[model samples]
Target: MVRGVVRPHRVLSGSWGEVIASNLDYHRATFRWKCEGLSEAQLRRRAVPPSELTLLGLMRHLQGVERHWLQRTLAGTTPAFPPYKTYVTAAGDEWYDDSDPTPAREVYEDYVRACQESREVFARATADTARIVPNTEFGATDVRFVLEHVIEEYARHVGHADLLREAIDGSTGE
Candidate 1:
């Protein structure tokens, strides 16, 4: 498990925003906990057969996901930073493989930074009923929906990450 990842206390009773935000942060920390203390090779190793999944790959994937939702969708603007073309797969998955030569440290740092930026965005956001992507082809959705969707996304991928981490070092935990 990763050090310095403090999962926020569960909000048994609070505003809707508070509860969902806490859950999202919990899943985020769990993802990081699953990737702690691993070397570049260990992070990139394809532990599960017939799967391209890797810890570093997940980190990169989540980084894109965070940006896609909060930075693009929520902020409703293009990203100011350089894109992540070099990290994604040819099939458009936000992952890497044996051919990807990026250092593990960069991937990990990018994820942490993205998570922080997401938190900032969430903090500054308006009420849950506020419509996102108003009048767009994506249809109307609210902040609550997007936040919950991101939480669901994190939970699903964290499960994948849990399996990958276990296969990598034979270690496992919540």
Candidate 2:
């Protein structure tokens, strides 16, 4: 789905890069598996009443996350996001806020592209080097640290996807 990284499991040129890349691939596949075989309506169907997480919404939010982390941060862009004030909207502001919004397709497209681009970025980042990263709830370090963060994020979401998928349809597992 992404343009930068293809199969995250394929070994690249470096040992560390290969390990991180593999995790990336693993999460991408896991994410796809969680999202498999559902129509647009099914993807957008909410798991519980008054809750803000539909699979479609989750997908949108994932795209937003990629855009922020890779396209914005990794790419070293100054502005973190668009100038729209609605970026502060609680629910669909970042992900699937709109009920049946037309731009959902666009968000998914951007999401995939961002993932691929991040893969390329990581390759170019000289995975052999070190850098400083901010302190997160998960602790802090640099690029390697961030990659670990990315993997954890994807893993957590994949689990969420599993439960959500089960609720959406009786289907489960890879």
Residues 23-108, candidate 2: write the lDDT tens digits: 77778767766776667777777776676677766776665566555444444543233222123354533334546465545555
Candidate 1, overall lDDT?
0.75
lDDT of 1 by residue, 78-174 (tens): 6544244455557764444445666777777778888888787776663544665552424678776777667878988999998999998898888
- lDDT of every predicted structure (CA atoms): 0.75, 0.62
Q: Candidate 2 — number of clashing residue pairs?
A: 4
**Alpha-carbon TM-score of each model against the true structure:** 0.84, 0.73
Cα RMSD (angstroms) for every candidate in the order listed = 2.9, 4.8
Best by TM-score: 1
Candidate No. with top lDDT: 1
Off by over 4 Å in 2: 1-14, 75-100, 126-129, 134-140
